[model samples]
Target: MKDFPSCFGESGVQVADFSSSTSRTAQNLVSCVYQCRLRGRSRLITVSWSKNLMGQGFSVGIDDNTNQCLCKVDIKPWLFSKKKGSKSLEADSSKIDIIWDLSSAKFGSGPEPLEGFYLGIVFERRMILLLGDMRKEAFKKTSATPVPSDPIFIAKREHIFGKKIFSTKVQFCDNGQLHDLVIECDTSAVSDPCLMIRVDSQTVMQVKRLRWKFRGNNTILVDGLAVEVFWDVHNWLFGTSLGNAVFMFKTNPSAEKLWVSQPLSDPHMLPWSWSQRFQDSQSQCLGFSLILYAWKNE
Candidate 1:
């Protein structure tokens, strides 16, 4: 299974459904992809977390450098009683084991566990990725040797809900300092709504006359690096009360090259599909993409 970003690239941008997704399916869902080097080869591992009426669940998917899925497994805490269990599969001619113990996991408003749990991915008895604080428990359960080299986080997609202020914490680079990201916009309050973005409570980028600039891209500096910000608030201004908005923060590999590479015909067009870019050669230049689907409750 592939983890697709709701926001697409500009060169071949095409609109995708954001307003039609049910609140349950589109809320509290987060997926993260990691780049791991195993046996001298690079591979991607996608871990997705979600919650439903049954309880919380997650899925782990392994893909090769070519973006081909080698194996995947879904763990449902309530249904399959998978709160504490492991699964084994074959990938790259090696035995791949995914072990997890979410029975003691702690969570906040979102689906992801805050702590008190461990999820490990073992390749040929070597631990490639381990999450959560229960490292000792994870190693004891998997009996896999922890490697010195850990995987690098590549991309993430999350669903956020808010009224005027949408807030989240993010790190622009691997092992980078965490920063507070806040997106504030109240279309109804002002005669002309302005979209303001802040990093660590300091306003960095602001779009005035949001009605005309509802869909566009801008570059901002963070941690001494350039980050391209793309947003689409079309549904927020024109669609129903349940309509949602999309925003993306893409960094690494020079955001300038990524934008200049695309045709400048449509200045206000938003991204279409991140999965499509992965298939194209453009994926090599694209570094990290943070896609956020902001749902308004009003």
Candidate 2:
């Protein structure tokens, strides 16, 4: 399969581009992309949360509708003396600001904070993207007018470390049921290595002779919604050490449309039918994409 661009690139999977020396799988990070509007113009904001030996930190990047980056700001962990502050920038003669407070934030195993934190992106004194539970605190701290932009959660990319079985919790829908996801693959057997995916302790998808079918897509029903699952495990089956596999779960209308659009000649180059979904998600939308970079822990 033709290797697609690293989905986790925006999520801090590879820090080299971010001018960091950390290895790909060394740091725990999560990248979430949101579709928001500012001054009647739609834009995409990428919020990345990272945690390493130094502690937790985050970065905010704003991109236009055409995917052109308007501005990017990195808040280093050491620079968080107040742990809550605002950074203002000029974008197209307009003021773009990023405000955050993580001093009293509570976190779980992941880099993202669970509570007592607020990260707000304000444009022209209007809050475009707001995260965390402290909405009132975020508005009060930033002095941003309460304009409801209603940012849509479009995509999420995360790195998961494991050996044979990788597990994580994800919610397919907003405020929906959170399901347990388990991916088990024993690649020790070069001849016959089976791959299985379980959701909520139930097998949702399985591939028996995974060697030949290392890269493909499947459709599984979750919460009465069809989820298109795309997997690329070519590195796991054949590659040097430190190789990682990529999996994407997207909620779409019809799985047949996703499969039929692909050319049958080359199955490896799985043309992800995301152009339409991406457009829909930005416009009249409520689509969620979860991308996991599974790293084998040796």
Candidate 3:
């Protein structure tokens, strides 16, 4: 109840509802957006990684200031012979090359690879966005020069599943230390469910009488920085048994807009408009946002 803002000016503010996000809450997916300078112009590249019965797949898209998808590519490289490959596409009349090698990539429970992989985006013979631990292999394969304009990771959205406690590790800021974030709640066990959030094994925020205050926003200090957190669990308490809850962590300095109802596609990705809002949130340079669609396994 403390440190939670209940107003924007004198009028009360409520979270916006995302068209849909429930179906994909249990899927293994991670979407990240990066901002980089291309030829002195700001650009954003979105990469989405997914894991399902068919195998692992990824998609890359380039968007300019106008929110237009200049070029995009989707690759399912899990087959034996196609584990590594390169794709060339033109965006804004500029040739762009995307390369990847997941032959030996290691993955955890989630869709994102843990290590042993290289996904590179090259432009004008220079590396713009390079991910994974295989830097040497990426540069060698791409034949691109290293420049000072590496991409800035601004936002990440992940879907996590659990029985009652959902947990993940994340970095709140660019080059910031990684911390463990955990959310715990048991709707069926109690008449009035409570919400608890912990960071690095320490309790940072908790809400009692969750049935009455099922939706709200609070601010917590992390690493000497203010982090705004918002949660909505109406579905968890009143919806079907498989309903999912929403949680978001924002690091915007002046972020008065707390995300509540609006949220996420593929059978496993967010919906069109929902995903659009997620990506659009990044274009605003709103520091970093981490949205977790926590689904209960019960």
Global lDDT of each candidate = 0.73, 0.73, 0.73
User: Model 1 reaches what TM-score against the true structure?
Assistant: 0.83
Candidate 2 per-residue lDDT over residues 1-298, each given as its tens digit: 1222222235422342211224544468787887777777777788888877677788887766555567777876556567888899777679998888888999888888989999998888788888999999988877888666477777777778787999888888766798999999988745789999999999999998888888788889999988888887877888745677878898855433443334322222445543344445444554787878787877
TM-score per model over all chains: 0.83, 0.83, 0.84
Q: Could you tell me how far off, in angstroms, the CA of residue 184 lies in candidate 3 after the best superposition?
A: 0.5
Which residue pairs in model 1 clash with each other? Answer: 8-271, 8-272, 8-273
What TM-score would candidate 3 get against the native? 0.84
The C-alpha stretches of model 3 lying farther than 4 A from their native spots are: 1-26, 77-81, 258-285
C-alpha RMSD in Å of predicted model 2 compared with the true structure? 4.8
- The number of clashing residue pairs in each candidate reads 3, 1, 7
Candidate 3 lDDT at 7 equals 19
